[model samples]
Target: MISSNTAQPMKDIYLPEPADVLKASPMTALEMFFEFRLASGRELGHMPGQFVEVSIPGIGEAPISISSSPTQKGSFQMVVRKVGNVSGAMHALSAGRQVGIRGPFGTHFPVDGEMKGKDILFICGGIGLVPVRSAINYVLDHRDDYGHVTILFGTKTPADRLFTDEMQRWASAKDVTFMETVDRGDDAWKGNVGVITTLIPKVRLDPARTVAVVCGPPIMYKFVILELDKVGLKADRMYVSLERHMKCGVGKCGHCQVNGLYACQDGAVFKYSDIASVREAI
Candidate 1:
């Protein structure tokens, strides 16, 4: 028999692209958006807090943060807030509607082996919780891999809260400390009635051994970082996920550029130290 390598040059086999609309389903009021699930139980092969770009033929694409954890296989979730044209179009979509996806992109919040066994303070504001929720769930799923897990989450109001069902579960989770705040309140709203910063002072944390993962509106980051510093958390120990109008999702499009960093490619997640000088990062 002829040796395979010497007998014929390796040939590249190209496959047709798969359909864009992932496993689309309506869950509660929010569309339960899924991108890549196979009936065979194949995993998304993603890291927590990364994102995927979803596209429609005529409407173009948008970079959406993956809200599900890597621990969840077979599918990934993206919580679209229905704020823009693409998202608006997505809102009208029904189950099995085809949408294109390209990603699992951006640098994930550092969960290096070193981060294991350290205390974690997770902070989220508004729908900003959507992205950070991935990391929080990943850590929570592997509870023994770390020490204390404290989550400080806030929303514009109680009605605007995302992941309500999951939040209830997390609030009562063993060994996890969960707190929430609302900027404005309705008659039905109880719990903390102030900015998320108000809740920060109540959860005591050891700054030396703690790492903070924060995501929120641009305004919230500036104020929250100050609070974290006041409590003695180091800049390097704090990470933030930035929001910018990203187009290409691969850094080629200049839409998501903040100073010299591309929020699409270089980040959507950045450590405080990495972009300290980037005035526009906030």
Candidate 2:
């Protein structure tokens, strides 16, 4: 028999770890904000733009993007929309409830890597804001590490806004430029009303130093890329998080394959220039 000290530990990649819900609250009619802490008391080491597989015993498991920044200590967060069985079950969970978490998988935004010293322009539409928020907060926490910060958010309606309180705080921050719009407005809405691409032309930045991050509904990508190109932002300088049916957090499952690349293993976040040649990527 091998000595216990010398034997390598075998870890099961498919087994889920237990995590306790620290807080659960509604962000919108269909979306719920969940904060969880690993039962083992360790931080969920993850980077911005990565996703985790959240599972509820008998229901199912779904890949949800990690919404909180790594700078946030103790616990991690996810904004879950009640779109299916697993997410519906997740909505019923509250603080103290325990669930299974598989991974913080996929490639992440280069926040501390290539992004250092460069200006960040965040363009998010609808639920797309969830993943990008991680990078946004990371930049804010280490504000001095980067150049300027610009955030543009657009949703279907004013009532559909997520993180209203945080949006106000971001807008009020000294060095950050925050702008929001809605496709349609209500009687109380006073901000810009149009698709998110319209806001791109209004902001001024040096294309040489600016890195644009875009995430939103599937239809939003092509139009947003066009708008960014018109504003002098090169495809190489832009990054996007593509939405796919990622069944397994690891690449073994072929569910999230786009062309020859696996969204789960290769990327959920990819440089526009790199994936531009892949027909299904955009």
Q: What TM-score would every model get versus the actual structure?
A: 0.88, 0.97
Give Cα distance to truth, residue 53, candidate 2, Å.
0.4
Question: Which regions of candidate 1 deviate over 4 angstroms?
Answer: 1-42
Point out the worst 10-residue segment of candidate 1 by lDDT.
11-20
Tens-digit lDDT track for model 1 on 233-273?
99999989998888877778689989888998888888888
lDDT of 1 at 170: 88
lDDT of each: 0.80, 0.94
